[model samples]
Target: MSTQKRTVLITGCSDGGLGAALARAFKDAGFFVYATARNPAKMQSLAALDIETLQLDVQSQESVNSCAARIKQLDVLVNNAGGQFVMPLSDVDIEAAKKIYDLNVWSQIRVIQAFLPLLIASKGMIVNNTSIASVAAVPFQSIYNSSKAAIASVSETLRLEVEPFGVKVIDLRTGVVKSNLINNLKETQHPKLPDGSIYEFAKDTVEKALRQDGFEGQGLDQAVWAKAIVGDLMKKNPPALIWRGESAWLSRIASILPHGLLDGTLKKLVGLDIVEKAIKEGRH
Candidate 1:
């Protein structure tokens, strides 16, 4: 046992998502946990667990700073809150796209920056809850995937930058796990495509894809991933990138395939024929 009882702070801990699972696992592993979300009431169930729930709106500087001030030390910080918006690039409102990025990427950055001093003080670690989408570039989910992709790159850079300061940065590439992200996706639909838009065909495909309750692939088990993540965090030497869950290996394969192959696969899966025909015919 590492003698030192570390503290872990996780964000976006709804009742049964990855964050909540992490909170429970870390607590069971003998770490003090600060579990946070936009609404503390949503986390009422967590109150019964061995953890402290706090209010944290990652996009708000005031909220991030305030929480950072209250924590005297931190052994691990997990940026686990993020979700997808159901809007094609052509129909995507600029404000909505920005909203997705703000929560998925910038919010994680803000939380990490605000707590850097404390993490360093404890010579701790950071576990960025990134996704296979980070590298796979899924169609109809460009914004969400891209935002996570940005975080993965950021995690890589930060690992090196902060290593000399005695803090380890780990990027966790998670595959689909049973969570509320699918159920809570925000839908942004424009009845008519924007004039001269290039993505009119993508609109319908995007809608259908978003409506589908993501296939809980045999690999997408929440409890299993949670256990694996906890095991890594408790290791004597943790890996820089922890890849697990149903789609983890598959997405990694997608990331390395040639662009043509990747695009063709995505097209077939997302009903590209409908969108492509719409594009050629200029039908909004």
Candidate 2:
């Protein structure tokens, strides 16, 4: 009878976020869980649960190396640390967008490359937490949307490349899940339409639409979401792509639909129809 508990390490486990929720779920599932965040102070609640907490800045090679060097065994690696940015694509802040890509896309690759030796040694799994946004083309989220799309592509290719090493890769095409993502954004920067921007006419509508879901709590409960995700990952033969959380079905549907079919509806939902009207009226 083997009594060795499986070990799992998750990044971005700050309190009130999806990573924290996932760390709890994995802990409850009886795995040895390492919950990490750049600021370890934010993970106090997780630490109180006796879950091992570490500092991990996914964007820093030094941080990634330091974190990996401490872990002696790992069965699952969840690339869950990420951020969101919302703004009109036309006037997108190139530097801000680049930061988003660095955190959301390249950082995942960096972490994977740093930890591949550990994953390969265990014949473990790599779960990349992507979003339905990757396929949905939601309004005013071009930077976020594109970054997610890029990771999805990376996960797809990495799955094949890692399979030969007996490692599994799962692209978690997440839907809306209740977390601190939006609130954190608001607290940090309060995203707004830039001054004198072309979309200024639709500023209130666009910004409201952007924050609506987060404020209204329209997503699935994070604990439930994490439980479902962990269950899938625990399967003897887990899926290559796992879609869970609120509105995940919509992402699946959108993926198969003809391109541009949802553009009009998506636009109207985010008040882009009003923007279009203003543009046609030459009111700017």
Candidate 3:
């Protein structure tokens, strides 16, 4: 218990992503950071800095328990390691959907459940990296959107429940962060795509959506978000939800929009109408 240094653990940190940036930010702020990923070797960059990298896969109970057992003290817990896959509901594969949920939703739950005791002991803060898609259902990404939505719900409840213990739970609504998630999309055949079906037109559109992350030129700066996150965590009592990036406001607006209007808008924005047109043209 060094009074001068804080300890923070973050999940899903590899290289060139929000997690990595957060790791650097915490280290710069004079905190001991545990940068955890499924493959500890992926976080080699942290070696040059004053950060410890650990192996943690949220989906595996053993991995979560092992990591939790090793953590004796922690000031902050950042659940930043989750990913998304975009596929039409009609074309969504059950196994792929399960895997995505395993990573995005269940993993967070496992981590929080496992590490909650330590958080309570330190009276620390929990930052759950939710997304703009949590509230707004984007075309071709129903599952990812749902998972984040679930996180937002859990964060809200956890914040209240842990308040009595002096622990803060923050729901971070992030928009368009530069990350390697695009490069790691699972490449498998869609179960809903038969020899000829409506989903055939969606293959290209879905690919683009799955690979597309962050704004083209004005995405959220990972360093900026990281610094802000650490600063907020240092506050005596930080806000419950922190919206990061330019599109954060847009997501708020979308969340309040009428269902019909929102669906129409998303369909146009994500090119679902184009896919429908292609299907009509017998492109499958």
**Each candidate's lDDT (Cα)?**
0.80, 0.89, 0.80
List model 3 lDDT by residue over 67-167, tens digit each.
98887888899999987677668667789888888888888989999988888988888999998889777877889899999889989998899999988
Error of 2 at 214 (Å): 6.6
The best candidate in terms of lDDT = 2
Off by over 4 Å in 3: 1-4, 186-194, 201-207, 213-218, 276-284
Give a tens-digit lDDT track for model 2, residues 1-284: 12278988899999999999999999999999999999999999999999999999999999999999998788899999999988889878899899999999999999999889988988999999998989888888889999999999999999999999999999999998888787887877677777888777777777786665435466899999999999999999999989998889987988899988888988986788988888899886
- Per residue, candidate 1 scores C-alpha lDDT tens digits across 11-63 of 99988678998888888888888999988888877898747999998989999
**Cα RMSDs of all predictions?**
3.3, 2.1, 2.9
Candidate number that wins on lDDT, 2 or 3: 2
Worst 10 residues of 3 by lDDT: 186-195
Candidate 2 residues lying further than 4 Å off, grouped into runs, are 1-3, 210-214, 281-283
